[model samples]
Target: MPIYVQMARCCWIICFLVFSSLFRAYEASPGDSDQLYRACLSQCQKTSCVGARCFSCCNSASDGSPLDASWYNIKHLYFWWNHWDCQSNCRYHCMLYRENERAELGLEPVKYHGKWLSRRQYGFQEPISVAISALNLVMHFHGWRSFSNLIYYSLPLKPDKTPFYDYAGLFNIYGLLAMNAWFWSAAFHFREMDLTEKLEFSSFVALLGYSIILAIIRSFSLRTDAARVMVAAPIVAFATTHILFLCNYKMDYEWNTKVCIGMGIAQVASWSIWCGATEHPCRWKLRMVVVGGIFGVVVKMLDFPPYQGLVNSEVVLNASNIPLTYMWWNFIKDDAEFRTVNLLKKVR
Candidate 1:
């Protein structure tokens, strides 16, 4: 071959080899550090080989350089960005380096650093936390004072005896009245408030009031059309309103709203049966056997885990905790324990 031709062929072969090697390196998986380093070097060399036609090629190429100091710096930066520690280090490094660079260039870094900073003097507590705390307090009070024992249960009739009012029955009636009073008080308090306040107050009070009343009545009566009306009205009303509110606001506190509604409905059903039976003792045994059993099952169902998901809120509790906490004091009694036990026996 001619001397010039031979030299040109040799150059072409060298170029081909270099291009192929770089291509292979770029295609290598980044899982292995050694492989990644090699790939970076290959990419840098390939870029440099192409010359300055590629603007910003110098920075890109420098990333792969094999020089110990250059490689170490690039590797450190890569790890910093990819690892879990990046979140903490990123802000610090960006600020420090950007600041130093800006100072050197006689330019000011932007005032808004893109980092989250607290502007408000106060931090808000979560609603769920507040709710849990309130629940704990109520549970504690109920436990210590035996407030939960105030339920009513009836006995089957005996041939020579007449039905009589039991302590449980009396407590149940009183408990209903007290719950109703508190509920109405809250409703009035929030009557002039904003949408959020209205929703919170209305939802809570409605649920609680309706449930307690139902429980009171059921402990005394049996199934009847009147009982059904009383039991269903508040539940349907609350559920309808709650759904409307949710549709408008997409609030996360809807759980409590739903729970309240469900409990209200359950209590009404339970109480109506109880009351219905009380109103007609001749048919009471039969009516209680059917309606009473079903009502008991329904109330138990309301206490299940699925129902709990509806009302378990930290945010609601937190927001309403102080008021609820204070309100609970009003429900406390010196004789709460005795009353509660009596009430529980009646209900049972």
Candidate 2:
């Protein structure tokens, strides 16, 4: 044989040996034992093996018993379509069933056997699992669809006014609301209903409420230019951060954080620029930027336990300790978008 062929054969043998060793190790591992138990439980439930004992069969088999009740129960339940009550059986019966099934069939039962059998046997289960799956899929699709529509409609092709702007404005408003919904959901999930947590959560709700009121006022004030500018700032900032992350560019923490800080600076600068160009341009915008910068610096400086930096990096902060940071990002992005849209209208 050629030297290259000989080397290839050796490599193949080495790969096979490595895989075999790994498989053996996995089978011996404590974690794998827990996984096996979960797998067995899931399979038994799916097969509709009612009142079947599980633990006795596993233990008996481990002790080298001749009877394989677990295997029999699994096979029987797998073949027969039955009720959910099968899942609540005594551990001993299920174990015996498992042992019997294993002795007869020489293999463990499959997961989700009930659903698969139902589809094959009775055409489908009531409240068809497929329908539920489809509903979930459509919900995800709609979320992306809404995002795409917002992007397409919000940006002006030319500098002049057109119907596209109005459609885009509507889409953007809806998109912001949807984003708020996502944040609120996250807040609610984290809330423990404790007095302190409840108070913090309520503050988030208030912020969202105030944002909605501001949006409504802007819509009615005929200040679309200012609103466009405000809204655009956050959207652009966020989009920029997203693009960077997608392109694998390293930014400080996640894209959302960069966007939050960016939007805050941009909004203040836009206001300052506007003021400077107009009569009596005060230093309020500059002051706001300085204050925000100082606050960020202070946050970085004061690193308490659990509120300290993230484990992965020096600068990156732990998410659990920085609820306020997330709030800041959302608020900045929202305020910036609203202001940007309105500003654009002024220029137009």
Candidate 3:
């Protein structure tokens, strides 16, 4: 085989491996599974043959667990007729015995789920985060409406020969990506399934990286299609590689966080510098967007959280998008009016 063909085959195999990793589900730790509990219950039952609490005999007075016989009894009584397996009943009784001993020693009982106060206060799902993500989706809709008007009504007003006017389709795609990112964010907060979480993170990274591409193109006045494509291609490639690495390689939270923060800083800096240097009437609106974005970034930085109510970093970022979207609408409308006026002048 030709060397190039051999390389292509290697590439295909690597791609297959990367994609295969995405389908692999995250497995919980052994303790969270029922197998160990069942095995322990079996041994306990075979030895003692208790009525409903097989592990009841496993407790010792020296361990201070004997004082919690009533606690174990409560669990045994609860699971007596529930069709629970021997292991499950034994596990429940053991849990009560442990908690009772912890109470005696004045130590907090170990949490089986996690230390997240959000789960304790609001159950599994963070409703506030979901609501904020929904609001962000609505904001994206408003942005899309403005962008649609800009494309359908305003874009056509430009001289058909202009290369810049041809970017309406690309702009529409970028807008759709933004909206879809928000949609996934909402879905993740609503259910927090593994797939949804991955989608949400991947979508957000795509949007953030693409926004940097847009900023560079728009700021440098890259009008020609080729120029825009050339400017965007590398960033898009980087974004794609980042996503593949996350799915296939180690999903290191610190590494992902640093990359995201760097991209965000670049995006904000590009827009801020452009707005500051330009003399457009909409500069103040862009400044407002910068302010809102910075506030969102600050919220993200202070993300050590109980994750309850509206205190979630994702929720605040989603809410911040509202003002930024409205400001973008006003700025785009201003630009559209400028384009319409210029077109009419040429016609006359």
Lowest lDDT 10-residue stretch of candidate 3: 112-121
What lDDT does candidate 2 reach at residue 282? 30
Better of 2 and 3 by lDDT: 3
Candidate ranking under TM-score, highest first, comes to 3, 1, 2
The whole-model lDDT of each prediction reads: 0.38, 0.36, 0.61
TM-score of each: 0.24, 0.23, 0.63
Off by over 4 Å in 2: 1-185, 188-256, 275-348
| C-alpha RMSD between model 3 and the true structure | 12.8
lDDT by residue for model 2 (1-348), tens: 753344334433543343234222111212223454456566655553324433222233344451556665676655333322233332223443444464488854321211111111142222232333233234433543544444456544445644323334544454455444344333322221233223323332333333333333332333456755654464445344454443353222222222333333433333333333333223343345335544553443342211111121112222222333333334333344455466578877
**CA shift at 118, candidate 1, in angstroms?**
11
> In lDDT terms, which candidate is top?
3
Query: Which is superior by TM-score, 1 or 2?
Result: 1
- Model 3 CA deviation exceeding 4 Å by range: 1-117, 120-124, 154-167, 307-310, 343-348
lDDT (Cα, tens digit) per residue for candidate 3, span 188-240: 66655457867987998899888877776665656788977886787788789
The worst-scoring run of ten residues by lDDT in candidate 1 lies at 116-125
lDDT of 3 at 42: 61
